[model samples]
Target: MSLDTTTLLAIVAMALVTYVTRIAGLFVADRLVLTGRAKAAFDAIPPAVLVAVIAPTALTTGWVEAIAAAITAVAAFRLPLLGTVAVGVISVVLLRNVL
Candidate 1:
């Protein structure tokens, strides 16, 4: 199979842009100090983004996935990150098999 030139160029460009953006973020992050509401907001971002991504898939897929997602959300609050992920995976697998 032959590699297309345009595809290769696009891939290279994307890699370069990602690398530059990460490096820029690192430099900016060194000088950045978040406080009070800003710190709280910043801390919330990861979970918010996680929900934003997973919510659609969980809601759209099926009842079993929806239930599993709900269970996972509850576990997320009670458990640590790894435990939460474990619950999500295990619940989904068990639900898919049982229902």
Candidate 2:
């Protein structure tokens, strides 16, 4: 199969843009500081993004997934990121098998 010129150019452009943005973020992040409410809000971003990603899948799937998501949410507050993810995976697998 032959590579199309337009497709090759598009792929190269996308890769360049992605690399540039990531490098820029690293530079900007090093110089940035957060304090007070801003720090709190910044700290909350990860869990909020996690929930945002998980919520739609949980809501759309079924009661089993929704229950598992609830369990995961509880774990998120008490556990580290890896532990919370472990809980989510384990709960979903067990729930799917049992219910």
The TM-score that candidate 2 achieves is 0.76
Model 1 bad stretches (over 4 Å): 1-15
lDDT of 2 by residue, 1-99 (tens): 999999999999999999999999899988889899988998999878977997998999999999998999899889998999999999999999999
In angstroms, give how far residue 22 of model 1 lies from its true place.
Answer: 1.8
Number of clashes found in candidate 1: 0
By lDDT, the best candidate is: 1
lDDT of each: 0.95, 0.93
Best by TM-score: 1
Q: How many backbone clashes does candidate 2 have?
A: 0
Runs of candidate 2 with Cα error greater than 4 angstroms are 80-86
Candidate 1: lDDT of 88?
95
